[model samples]
Target chain A: MRDGEPLVRWAWIGDHVDELAHYTGVHLRLGLLPVLLGLLISIPLGILCHRWRWAYPPTLTAANILYSIPSLALFMIFVRYTGLTERTVMIPLTLYTLSVLIPNVVDGLAAVPDPVRQAATAMGFSTVRRVVQVELPIAVPVVVAGVRVAAVSSISLVAVGQLIGQGGLGYYITRGLQLDFPTPIITATVLIMLLALVTDALLVLAQRLLTPWARGKGAAA
Target chain B: MNGFLNQLSLVGDWLTSSQQWHGPDGIPHRLLEHLTYSGLSLLFAALIGLSLGLLVGHTGRGAFAVASVANLARAVPTFGLVVLVVTLAGLSTAPVLVALTALAVPPILINTFEGIRGVDPDARDAARGMGMTGWEVLLKAEVPMALPLILLGLRVAAIQVVATATVAAYPGLGGLGRFIVDGLARNDYELVIGGSAVVVLLALVVQAVFTALRRVVVSPGLRAPASGP
Candidate 1:
């Protein structure tokens, strides 16, 4: 047999476009599900804590403890119960997102200026209307900031699922390592970084669109 | 439920084994390797992050640039980076160290910059009025005031490195993770569980130690004042 291929070849990336697309789809799915799950759980929890006041510290402490658990260990520990399926991979990723997002949600809501909140109340808006209409609009930027961090982190971590034979761009990294072929590994690494950077840029753009009032202030500065 | 109990019992059994506790391939040796990898990486990251952060904070320039770059780097997957580096560098400690150092830098750098930037302007004015040089004002007044947050950055980086260094096992380096990988390969689920427990424990201990260090190092005056009735 001929000697093995070089560590990285641009031609191989072109040749494997279909396979790369499939893995990119898998990567996005795996990364995104956790962010959605975390947001689903944390938003209501954050709202509850924000309203109650007493619940915030303990809840945040618990989230911190959960965050400190190594993601790899958390993934393996779940394998016993989840049986090496996507559930095993997802449960840990979702928990990590919650750990990052809850505090941001709470802090964002807390940041609503007292006068603005009171002004909404004086206008005879119901509590739910005030929250959804007035408070949430102001809090969106901060909450979105948290989501941006969580989303990028989840995307990076989805690659770790390769250890348990889960999909994502990590497939190439593991496969290349096993075969000692550089092309797939290097190609996947660059692709994963690109995915992360592109997603981050999109989030920044979304934030700008959502908070148009800030544009005027920014220009003034 | 049964599987959970079984894993717990298996881990307990594995930990009780004196053989696993001592010798060349034992827990102590593995723990030492894990700590060494984490410590060296954190040290290197601190050196790079702190100096650059200080320069950025002092000059009041490049703060935004440094932060944007750090945020992007933070988004790079650590596992992928480690494997990629190892494939290029061969199966030595370099890849793990390099990857983990990259992982550790952002928090330290960001925190140092923020901490120094947050220093009280009044205190800075006082230092300047006392005829201190720019370097002296930064070293004496600004850094000390920023110590709490700077240490906070170090703590964050250190804990992250400790938790992440376990992946070094993949590249043929010895660490607490060896037990997890080896056990999984051998179908020894107990060893895997036990190894994970050790890693989680190490992370918690590191966090607690840093919390204690913060209390000791941060001046009492700088701490939040006690609430009075």
Candidate 2:
């Protein structure tokens, strides 16, 4: 909108750079915070479920159903109950991540090779120590992959949060599409892609470091 | 006048329809249309993505580069791509089709690339020994071995796209997302719930289709080279 601003280009990116920066941080924080919380709670929950067969189905089912909930619909539900804002976004997203990641954590922990668990049990290792040392290590790769998936899903879905008055990179996207201004919309689209790529790269780095023994290629494992 | 009354179901039509329990937006025909919109976008994405992916997966250096770039492409947000496509193609079907196909492409590309790459070198050598050319070996050997994994990738991509096509309503193409978006605008709870039911069903149907398709291509013995997803 300013004089000397280039039209038909992402030049608006510079003018709105601060708004974009402010919102991008908000977006990442909102996206990653729930994942961290999900990881913390689910790791123990997964182990407890693994240790107790009775706890398996319900814990797993709850999250699986949540995973199946469409983001747009779920976000609308949050909007109605919570009113529109990042808070609304955060709540549904946190719930959603738990559904996917918790189950993965549980399964990953359960999949710790029987021989390794047997050896630990035969060595008279304490249940807690055995879990913290052996099972947790083996499960980290799968759990991280789940976390990566959650992170990616949240960042993209959070764009919906823009409609609720949250000023994330999604701000430009929502406005741009509605206002017929390609500048903001395309800029926002490219920015989200860059954000996704960077986040994915970070996950890849984390995965490579966490699972040195995993021979499977790429960030997939 | 008599025919009009007959077509109106003697004024009792409302009682049997889902409108009372599920709301006005929950009518079966409307739900089917929503499914059709989402389903078609996914179908387009799969057909386009798998074709382009297979091409890149089996070809030379440029193909490899395209496949690698697709990894980053998958990371690109679907909502963002919608915005981009809307900017480039406007609010009609083109943007949505382009966006959904872009969303589907990366997984198909990566899976097919990896699947082909993962083909046994010894198998290629065996094919060549049998007087097969490079393309011959690729069709007869590489595709079959890699088909299962590639299909898995395509399956996952299909599932993701089914959910994502709902995002297209933001750019003006209504699918199940229409109910959610329009309902949100009007605070129509029934519409929201009814709309979500359609999305859930769409996801399930896509799941079922992929599961049945997987049964066809998954066996190790089914690794026929010319068989493409």
DockQ for each of the predicted structures, in order? 0.42, 0.31
Specify the CAPRI tier of model 2. acceptable
Q: Please write out the lDDT profile of model 1 over residues B17-117, one tens digit for every residue.
A: 89988887799999999999999999999999999999998888998888887788767877777777777777888767888998999989998998899
Q: Please report how far candidate 2 places residue A208 from its true position, in Å.
A: 6.0
Query: Judged by DockQ, which candidate is best?
Result: 1
TM-score of model 2 vs. true structure: 0.74
The digit string of per-residue lDDT tens for model 2 on A90-124 reads 88778877766776777788788999999999999
- Show the lowest summed lDDT stretch of 10 residues, model 2 chain B: B220-229
Let me know the DockQ for model 2.
Answer: 0.31
C-alpha lDDT score of every prediction, in listed order? 0.82, 0.69
RMSD (CA, angstroms), candidate 2: 7.7
List the pairs of residues colliding in candidate 1.
A7-A182
